[model samples]
Target: MKVDENNGTLAEARGLSGKKIKISKKGATPPPSVENKMSVGLIYVNEYYSGWKELCFRVLQSKFDSPERSFAPDQEIIEALKNCSIGQEMNLKQVQKLCMPFIRFKKDEAREVGTQALDLKLPFSEMDVLRENLELIRRQLGLEHVEVLSAFEVLSACDETAHAKAGENVKTAESESAVPW
Candidate 1:
């Protein structure tokens, strides 16, 4: 899957090595076959105080004018979100905090994501209807929480023990498959 920045067409194709791929709009394409489908993690900026909601919305609107920004997300959309600066005048820290337990699924549910990243609003009030509607969509779509990288997991995964354990698991699987059946 490759997202064209100039034209907003997402192309899906296999590479020379017969691996699925996703090329981001920003030209950063990670190795394919890492994951079956692309999973985008959302970072919700909770309102800090009174009027903070308005400010946060404004900051968001400056980048994404879509009413469905909260729901549907893609590569470019997530990148725009991370780069948004909040309360520049107030000297507040930017939204750099990444939350854990990302909203993900085992299978590809890209169609269930929100509308396209357009600047125009939908006919209905998406914000008002989102809370109730999103739950229904999730249940209907069978979305589930998948494992995402954590601080501890990231650190532990790089050690020699983790590598050895992975090797042992592969060997065990191979041995088990050797049974005549």
Candidate 2:
């Protein structure tokens, strides 16, 4: 993936088929910011066509511009979440959901979350209704403060907020430390 932070564009990702696609920074859920590059981040892509809605979210690791792995929730995950109770303990798979939102592949190194080995592929494709629900899951988990702790933190939902606040503090400190001209 080629990342160009200079322009309004966010990043350019090459698909499995070698097609280069650029995700604009304009309408991004959380616009490109200094906080996005800290720790973890999420790049959500959504599209609506004739009678069809397609969207896919990629997990960003290290920096928002670099994506590791992409995932769309399968049907089983959706159903289980629909029946789940808020504050109810999430299973291993449910916990896995949190990691699904933020993985960056490292060459020659195996990436595993908890116990599940991650697939090191950028699986961006035409969106499906069920697949697109991945974003919803992230939001629900964060909003409800579901019991998945480590996984939730990896997903970057809550972490992003913390990072953003920290970024603000850094800026404040920088200005305060500036020497008068």
Model 1 backbone overlap count: 2
RMSD of 2: 20.2
Give candidate 1's whole-model lDDT. Answer: 0.32
Weakest 10 consecutive residues, lDDT, candidate 2?
49-58
Report every candidate's CA lDDT. 0.32, 0.30
TM-score of each: 0.17, 0.16
User: Best lDDT goes to which candidate?
Assistant: 1
Q: What TM-score, to 2 decimals, does candidate 2 have? A: 0.16
Candidate 1 scores a C-alpha RMSD against the true structure in Å of 18.6
Each model's Cα RMSD: 18.6, 20.2
Over all chains combined, what TM-score does candidate 1 have? 0.17
Q: Model 1, 69: alpha-carbon shift in Å?
A: 32
